[model samples]
Target: MAALISGAIDLGGTKIEARLFDHAANTQDMRRVPTPRDNFDSFLAALVGQIRWLEQVAGDPSLPVAISIAGLIDPRTGIATASNIPVSGRNLSRELGEALGRDLPLINDCMAFAYSEAHGGAGEGAATVLGLILGTGVGAGFVIRGDLPPRHAGLAVEIGHLGMPARALARHGLPIWPCGCGRDACNENYTSGTGLRRIAEWAGLSDPDPVHVAGRAATDPEAARVMEIWADLTGEMLYSAQLMLDPQVIVVGGGLSNIPGLPERLTGALKRLRLGQVSLPDIRIAAHGDSSGARGAALMAKAGKA
Candidate 1:
């Protein structure tokens, strides 16, 4: 039988990526464009152009589309709520459907990561899997039995907003790690790439870049202090995850996941937090790097299920 073609959309704060994939989830073609500014119509138009490009490459206008986007979406209404992008609180699936003259499946970006990980990444063969993304923000998804994808109920696991004293200490209520969604301590304020910068500043180091600060942490005492705090906070978050789902594997993705020593530091912290005799959850960096979300979005398209 001929392989099926699928289209995937990854809507990030800074860019929107669309790609065409085959049944094996190999990306056949892809394009990425900067996310539009405040104009909603303009953003839609930009996305449409990307889709058109993918269509031209794959020669399949009727290709099944699966979407992954930052922020929260009401699974029932399919409305996307993103603060950084222009499409916040809008029903993206409905909008795309209206534009393309057909319905499209939309899932949270983190859920897509979990889906992809379950299929081929660290979560393979795991009954319960937890996917964690620490990028411009932090988010999570729980996959059961590696097949039954979790429903997008507007509440799978906004783990970033799990609340941390670090958030208030660093962001000081600024839009710095904004979480008006009313969750306390907001984990993103400390662990995200942006949040890590805040941690650096709080430690009296002036490096405004997360990558730079993480690098400095290796030699600079103050910067290392900041990382230690981040490690503790992240370890606590993982412990929370371990207690709740007892996932067989935890796949960590996003920009911060690439920072040197992050995996070991977080793992060591988790070891310190161990409860009586429970086996530590196997934790590892996502096999896919920063492109994990985009790739996962493509995988979602192939699966054709949310």
Candidate 2:
């Protein structure tokens, strides 16, 4: 039999990355193009073009394709909702599959990240892994034994949308802020990289970029204080997540995870909130970096084929 190969696409707000990979997650060929933001038709065309290009490069017209999209796809309705993409509320899977004459599995990007880490990246060897992303916004994926837990309505693990703990908000004198999701006091408003900037601004800092704030944490007392609160708020969320999921390992990814000494600071905060004799969960940085999404999509395709 011919070696099994699959095509994967990582669909983000700014760009779409397509790759062909073997069963082992090795990249065979890859291409990238700007994501179409003007209309759904243009966006669909871009995906069709990328998949066709991949099939041509592989010389296999029947290659399975999977997408890791920065959005949610309701399994019941096949409708997708992404803040950055134009496909919101559309049955993207059906449309794209019809255009290509093949079934295309759509996985949430964070879920893909978790699957990738659980298989061979940071969460390798762990029975349950929580892939946490702390970038412009916050999101997470829960995986157990190399597979995601069953999800209903595509929202089982939307931890970012949960409300902030009232006590924590009161402690920091922070007001409940509105979230893009049309809810107030969502965790994303206070724990994301954007949230870090919000904290900096609240503290009267001139620079609100999370990178600059984290960089100045060492010498700048105000910046240090901002990060401290950020860490505390972030830790509060993780504390609840840890209790709920009891994951064996928590893999941190996304831009904010790059902050220096972040894992240690988070661990410290967790220690402070320890309720009993439960051991602190192991926290590690993501190993696959940006490629994890695409690689994971390919892996999902390959697994489905099996």
Candidate 3:
């Protein structure tokens, strides 16, 4: 039998990307289309049209489409409860599948990231891997061997939304800042790119961008102090996650992960917070970088399931 093609859709608020991958989940072709944010129908139309376009390019109408979205979808109900997108609080996949005349496989953005890293990227060969995103916003996912841990009620490995560590909070004197997840003092509020800038603001720095702060951390004493606090906060978060998931490697991704010396800082903080715990996981950066989600979604297309 001929190998199947994997059609992947990475949906965001602003645009929808359509790509085709070979059996090994390597990209063969890709294109981008603007997202329709007016309503669910428009959103569905955007994605469905993109999928059909990809099929035409592949010259194979049987290509399975896999979708990656921001929030987790309820597996039992097929309901996608995403934020920032117009289709939030709706069963997007089932509806899209109905329109497309096929059973579409879907996964959360974070889960896709983890799956990509675990299977062939940074976490390859590890028994267990944690994909952590310190991106524009913080997120995380867990992959055991080559599989993602089963989620309960569409919630799994959402370590970033957990409350700020009490110790880190006490030491840093951070306020109860609001989070997009409708919570205050969440890990994402401190561990993400905005979080780093927030720390700069609290420290009275005029430049609230992470790039500026990271650039100055080498020579400016105050920037170093901010990073120290960030390290402490991230350390507590990772240590707490380790106590629960015990992953063999935590692969860090996202914009802030590009900050030089961040991996070292994160590892140093983890060590300081672990209380000398044994069997420490190697903290690492993502190998696939920004493409993990699309690639992993393509993998799901080939797998025929999440």
- Winner by lDDT: 2
Candidate 1 vs 3: which has more lDDT: 3
Clashes of each: 5, 0, 0
Tens digits of per-residue lDDT for model 1 on 1-306?
146477788888888888777777766667889999788889988887877777667777776677777766787777778887788777877887788777767667888888778887878888888999988778998788865455646765777877664433453333334555655457777778777787677666877688887888878887777787778777878887888778888889888888887668888988987798789888878876655665676776666555
What lDDT is reached at residue 70 by model 3? 75
Model 3 clash pairs?
none
Model 2: lDDT equals 0.89
* Residue 239 lDDT, candidate 1, scale 0-100: 82
Candidate 1 minimal-lDDT segment of 10 residues:
167-176
Find the 10 residues in a row with the least total lDDT in model 2: 1-10
Q: Which stretches of candidate 3 lie over 4 Å from their true place?
A: 1-4
For 1-306, candidate 2 gives per-residue lDDT tens digits of 145488889999999899888767878778999999999999999989998998888788888778999999999899999999999989998999899898788999999888989988999999999999988899999899988887788863688998889999999999889999999999889999999999999999999899999999999999999999999999888888988898889999999989999889999988888778799899899998888878878888878821
lDDT per residue for candidate 3 within 267-301, as digits (tens), equals: 88888777566777898999988778888888866
Q: Rate the local accuracy (lDDT) of all candidates.
A: 0.75, 0.89, 0.84
Which stretches of candidate 2 lie above 4 Å from their native place? Answer: 1-4
TM-score, every prediction: 0.88, 0.95, 0.95
